[model samples]
Target chain A: MKSLSLKRLLVTSALLLWSLTSLASSQFTGPSRDANGNVVPTPKGEQCVEPTADMRANHMKYLLHKRDLTMYDGIRTKQHSIVACIDCHATPNEDGKIVRIHDDSNQHFCASCHAVASVKLDCFECHADRPVEAFSDADYDPVQQLDEALAHSDKPHALMNRKVQ
Target chain B: MSHLDQETDMKNTAKSSAPNKIDQYRRRFLGGSVAAVAGVAIAPGVFLQTVNAKPADQEVTANNRWGLLIDTTKCASGCSDCVSACNKEHGLREIHGPETDAQWIRKVTLKNKSTGHTINLPMMCQHCEKPPCVDVCPTGASFRRVDGIVLVDKHICIGCRYCMMACPYKARSFIHETLTDQLPHAPRGKGTVESCTLCVHKVDRGDGNTACAEACSHGAILFGDLNDRSSEISRRLATTGGRELRAELGLNLGVRYQGL
Candidate 1:
């Protein structure tokens, strides 16, 4: 009788768990849509694309205005980099870091994108080809800079014990 | 009643079964797991961000100095109140073309290729404790205010833009094409490199806070002395999950980025 009771309890618990999980799963997943409507894990890999008509429209507008066309009306510089703005902005290279905001190469930002679509982005005329110019930090201490530099250098020269050969 | 009496009559019917070692072990394991789960669920909520339960105006100390806590999770999309506020206060929209001269603060959106996630970040000067603009300045004119605001002394600015090269945020802008570009909205003089001052000119009169912070509809922008724990900026930094940009640089900037 005890063995029978144990088997009944296990079966009941298992059924309860399975039912609860199925209920939760069904509740979370809303109606699934078409191939182009949402992201699909393609055989090539999990491909990411701007999915909807609205999204494509939005990205297209951004692309038009923010296109990294270096030599536009307000370019303050005589020289421009042939490298496309899309080169650095859309994807991070091997270093796995975003283009530092100061990098002139980072033409892929939405603001930059918007500026391209809009007329006369004033800042870029001064900035597009040059380095990022911004405000100076106020709190640097000369004392700490040297200390940090030494500490940052290769492991205190590994405490080299020199033998006068 | 039958079941109650059966329990009470344990003295007569209590069959002393052999010690069910495996069952006992199973029961102990279940009990232990229940306790462990209870600890996990409750411990984090109570411990995390709880110290920030004090009034918004509580005072902060060193390491506690002024900083912003931009909650990325809470930031909403397609909102531009912060931009409008900046332009309105700085008088950019009135003349309104792209030449709306004062772009001290602006917003940018980025797509994380690995995740296909779209994140919007409101960009501003980091106001490094040890600012690169100050470090590279040959004239020593780009000085830091004791209160942690960085500024260009109009009297001394040469517009060389060396400080701009040193800044990582691309926050600086030179008044180029001022003859053609200065919008009737806010006419800026040529030859001065300018970026967000955090509204220092207005903050001096004690009239307005940073225009951007006041205008942010979503509270993405915050301003205050990190030294004062009670300051809005300080309190937010303490309890919020804000991480500084290039924190490894140890520049210790005054500004903080939110919702990346």
Candidate 2:
């Protein structure tokens, strides 16, 4: 009778464990999609450098290894670069706004999974979250450019005349 | 076999083996030549492409010692173009005053008390061969690259400020507040010491020039491989000569000043 009761307890605990994992898995909504139902676009290439499952499991390891190589050895390969990840993953929303990495919403690629996993991402604090082109040259004032050009120009008078023309 | 028969047998074996050995050597030579030809055919394009710029996969080696030659006489007084260029390139903004602000590069005006003669030059991390900062740092965060670029590895930097104290030029700066939107190439944050990276990103990209040197309209700043005898910096240094700041310290600085 004691053995039978122990079996019952084991069964119940196994069921509970199975339910708990399913519940947790259900909550994780992976990558988000836009209003048009389009997934994140891989701009540079057709797909990721590595397979989806491998990248999901070992992206951090790849990034960490690449970071050391870049920081110490100056090996700037795009294969496992954070810049490449940001460029590809940080897609614009329905409103065409690229969400910041630290945003509360699940729109940001790195932040979405990190928020669910309860991992604090401080990379965006120092590194740029958005792609280089996201910050457009439109904000760069022409007057300021001309001023800088003249200031640094060996023949300032010649440059000024060219700008005036 | 008898002694004479054994001798004849040995002679026969040697004669036969000699041709086989020669044939084996000939085959090896032909295979090697083919491989060498293929290597030469494939290597030149790759080598020429990476002549100025290093390939992304390649590690920077001591073969190239990057440096700058700043002609102080050509550096105009009150012109802070180089400073602005550096700030823009590294995304360093002036949030605080001079005491607290992170100045990677600054315009230093030196006036001789005796003659009243003044000189203006941009001062920055000397990129010393034997950096005092590297020596004093307990964490091994302050390091010099194989290519002679001195750097602070923020990953390991404990914010000790020992390097700052050890530095003779006062080149390093500690971030007091959290920073945002830093350049992808130049990742800086609060509680870590940073200085001029010598536009390492550009160097890696094969631009072979720094923002400050590129920005200087007066052509005062020249950047090149100090080790390369053909490089402009080396040629100029060899002919006209340049001096390091605090030469008595024997740091063997990468950056040199002309007309100091």
Candidate 3:
């Protein structure tokens, strides 16, 4: 009877592992289709979410807060939501790419779809979309910030909506 | 009071003093700031330490007084011209809730939970004179212009959120990804915090005039040289009872809020 129980458990674990792998593979396939059932490689377009080095760093931290929230898949509860929108949405290169030599906010990815749908878009509703030079705090690495947040979350070190001078 | 004697006396005093009374106070205040950041109360009259040997070139008003005036009373909550214009002028991604997205300007609909009175107001950077963000920036990447425009130097930013913590209005955001260039004005980069600058690049050119300020169908946002007596911003200051947020902090905020 014990041998039979062990056999059942092993079979169930194998099925779970198999299903997880299958889902991961499929997520990258859809939302990017070519005319003839081919996979579209450049879904993000020539432009991407554009943040300055500093703002991107901060955004990286902000992204962490939303890490668990970005599962975009509608079917799975754990599926992330926030995608590559931040890329090329904030600051763009002079040619509309993001780089050290150029930065601009008057560029974005919404027009592609909005034009097709003929929908007038409200920009500020979703994006702060400002230059990197506007804020007093646009100069920190968010990955480093993760450490701070972690530190702050610890006992005797927490700060929540705290005021600074 | 001969020049050489006075200079010598000043040096002696400097050598004798540990720090300026303000500096000592600021240190205590900075220490308390940590506590305050930890949700503790700070004793009154404390301030952040001034940047040592910092060039005065960064001084605002000494160069210019950049400011914004929003007339909430005239705001038509349902109309979103400013929002649309902002998108048109600055290419952006999908619309996001107030809690996310690097939005420089946004209309927040607030309903008084107890009173059931709802009010919608456009919000952006306050541009405080005593900006907490400036004090909290570890790299001093965040700074104010001589014209009172607060901005971040993206080149120098390390993406730390000290300034994010310093902001009282929750008016800042960090960039998250790389970008594609399509528009000349869309600011796209990676790793930096940002907010509205009253359209410095556009306003400086004497053309763009802030997209939201010009797009408001109801004249809710008014932009002008606060220094000019004839400017609409100055006129409103004289006639309107607009108030600043946390006014008691003495930050000399550039943005003014008037309830409709």
Q: TM-scores of the models, in the given order?
A: 0.43, 0.74, 0.47
Better of 1 and 2 by lDDT: 2
> How far off is each candidate at the interface, as Cα RMSD in Å?
30.7, 17.6, 22.7
Task: Report the lDDT of model 3 for residue B113.
Answer: 98
- lDDT ranking, best first: 2, 3, 1
Candidate that scores best on DockQ: 2
Interface RMSD of predicted model 2 = 17.6
Winner on TM-score between 1 and 2 is: 2
Q: Which ten residues in a row have the lowest lDDT in candidate 3 chain A?
A: A71-80
Lowest summed lDDT over 10 consecutive residues: which window, candidate 1 chain B? Answer: B55-64
RMSD of 2: 16.6
- What fraction of the genuine interface contacts, i.e. the true contacts, does candidate 3 reproduce? 0.00
DockQ of the two-chain complex in candidate 3: 0.01
Clash totals for all candidate models: 26, 0, 82
Better of 1 and 3 by TM-score: 3
**lDDT for each candidate structure:** 0.48, 0.76, 0.53
Per-prediction share of native contacts kept:
0.00, 0.46, 0.00
